[model samples]
Target: MKLLTCLKQIPDRDTRYEINAAGTGIKTSDLTFEISECDEYSLEESLKLREEHGGEVAILTLGPQRAEKSIRKGLAMGADRAILVRDDEGKVTTPHAVAKVLAEVLKEEEYDLILTGTQSDDWSYAQTGVLLAELLGLPHATIVMEIRADPAQKKVKALREMESGWFQWVELPMPAVLTIQAGISQIRYASLKGIMQAKKKEIRNVELSDLNVDLSSIPEIEVLKVYFPVVEKKAEILQGSTAEVVEQLVEKLKKEAKVL
Candidate 1:
């Protein structure tokens, strides 16, 4: 019944972002960070599963040193412990590289289930969880809205959300990975006592080198430039009698707008 949830730290949704001078990334100097919204749901799901099945819940995160704040918050929310893969150099940009690092850490551990957000807030790649599952050779389901675990039978049934308000049930054996969708469960707040106890919880930090992953070997999507989208506006008034105006509008739709 042991569960591992992957967490990520991202910029607050309300924060205004600016492209960096090199046009390669955003200027993060003044951005406020927090645990990603969907990841929070996954963490809450892990806590709920632990509560029902009587086992421990652990968090795994890969980010800069500042990410420890989010890990501590997860602990405060009821995670027993955490493993933080320090990436101060920011080398793990691609989803493949991230999955490789996480897979390396998971090699030494055993868990009945793994959870991750459907996608990250900043990049929205929506590929990390599936990639991690492939790397670990585990069965996985994405966009999961509900989970029913049978620890004794070593099987899990998940309800997956699909397009147009459709859902499908998927069953997988134990040691499976699931990409949790938001709104699957209500996230719990950290109580005062839990906050105090979180300070004493273990946060095992490891450098990227410790995992022996080579970032250069992984394929990456290059960002040639980052800029604000251009917006254009135009307006014209149709003047004439009702019949004339209708004709004019039709002509405009056929010629100027070309939408007819």
Candidate 2:
């Protein structure tokens, strides 16, 4: 029951964001970072599974040096160790590139299950997990609400979330991938003792070169620009009797707003 959970570091939602000078990305100089919301749930789920099944939980992430904070947080939350693929230049910006790098690191390792967030908080692309599964040639389920592993049978049963508040059960062989939905489990905070213990845990840091992954060869979705959305507000007062006002509102809906 070796569980590996992929975590991402993202800008804190409460931080103020500003578009960079090139208008191609956010200015991250002053931004605070944290573990992505759903990834925290994935980490918690991995920890729970390890606690129940008597195995080790590991964390894997690809990010800049600052991402070590998120990795340490996962270790403090009960992950046995971590692997950090340092991407200081941000070359691995696309989902395909990320999946490729992760798959490269995972090629030599074996795990009973791999977990990832349904989507990253910053990009919300929601493609990395599935792409990683494809790259690794493993069965995968997305938006998983629950997981039950039968290690003796080398299989896992997962409760998948569907549209309209529906759910479906899926069974897959061991060594599968699962994209965990947020709120699937309660995320536990790092206790003082856990934090101290995490200080002694191992964090193996590697670079893209170490994995022999060339990100430039990967196809990327181009982003032409990134800017704050324009917001405009206007108010018009309808004058006259109730019927006239209602008629004016209807006319505005059809002509001005065009939502009718």
Candidate 3:
């Protein structure tokens, strides 16, 4: 089985962000980037599959040169190699564009399975994997919490999550895509030796233009502005007997907050 996992580098959740002067995106100069949290789980699951099935695991990431750090992390975690779709212009910003690029790239590669996080931390767009499946004309399942593969049968049984703690088992043929949910497994840390070895792994960089991608087909999803959630503070005191304070709280919930 040849497995491919799509990973993304995103700004660390704790990093302080400032809107750029253009206001179209955040300031990138001093921002810290790391693998999207959920992608780590995807990468780990792909590595585990390779360990059991005896195959090569490769990663695909789309970003600028800075994204190589995250790619190396995947290599240290046991991916055989990586393919980077270099996008210095940041043109591949939307999930639509990402899926288009990945589909085009994967068209030339042969893989038994493709895995990706259910959503990206930065964009929270939970559509890439499914969209890629559509573009590639492959069967797919999303929100996959568990995966069981049968090499002889050339298929995988996926446990998919549903609303209100429900799950369904789906058997998909080989050459499929799955969007993995978080908490699928405990992600392994990179050992010093593995980190050193990762330096020797191959990372192939491909410019977006080299793919012969149709410029007319790429859709544009513009971001008009980027800003953090506004933080507001307010305090109220109900100075009265316990019963009266309770009444005030109820009133506040029903009227002021309207959350009742």
Query: Model 2: residues >4 Å from true position, as ranges?
Result: 232-260
lDDT by residue for model 3 (1-260), tens: 89999999999878778888998888888888999987899999998998898999999999999999999999998999999999988878888889999888898888999999999888797989999999999999999999999978989999999999999999999889999999998999988888999999999999998987775677777788887778674677787999999999999999999999
Model 3 spans with C-alpha error above 4 angstroms = 230-260
Weakest ten-residue segment in model 1 by summed lDDT: 228-237
**Which window of ten consecutive residues has the lowest lDDT sum in model 2?**
227-236
lDDT of 1: 0.93
Q: What Cα-based lDDT does every candidate model obtain? A: 0.93, 0.93, 0.91
**Could you give candidate 2's per-residue lDDT for residues 1-260 as a string of tens digits?**
89999999999977768988988989999888999998999999999998889898989999999999989999998999999999998978889999999999998777999999999889899999999999999999999999999999999999999999999999999899999999898899999999999999999998777787877789889888987778674678899999999999999999999999
Stretches of model 1 off by over 4 angstroms after superposition:
232-260
Per-residue lDDT for 1-260 in model 1, tens only? 89999999998878779999899878998898999988999999999999899899999999999999999999999899999999998978878889999999999888999999999898889999999999999999999999999999999999999999999999999899999998998889999999999999999998888787777878778768878888564668789999999999999999999999
User: What is the lDDT for 140 in model 1?
Assistant: 100
- Candidate 3 has a TM-score of 0.88
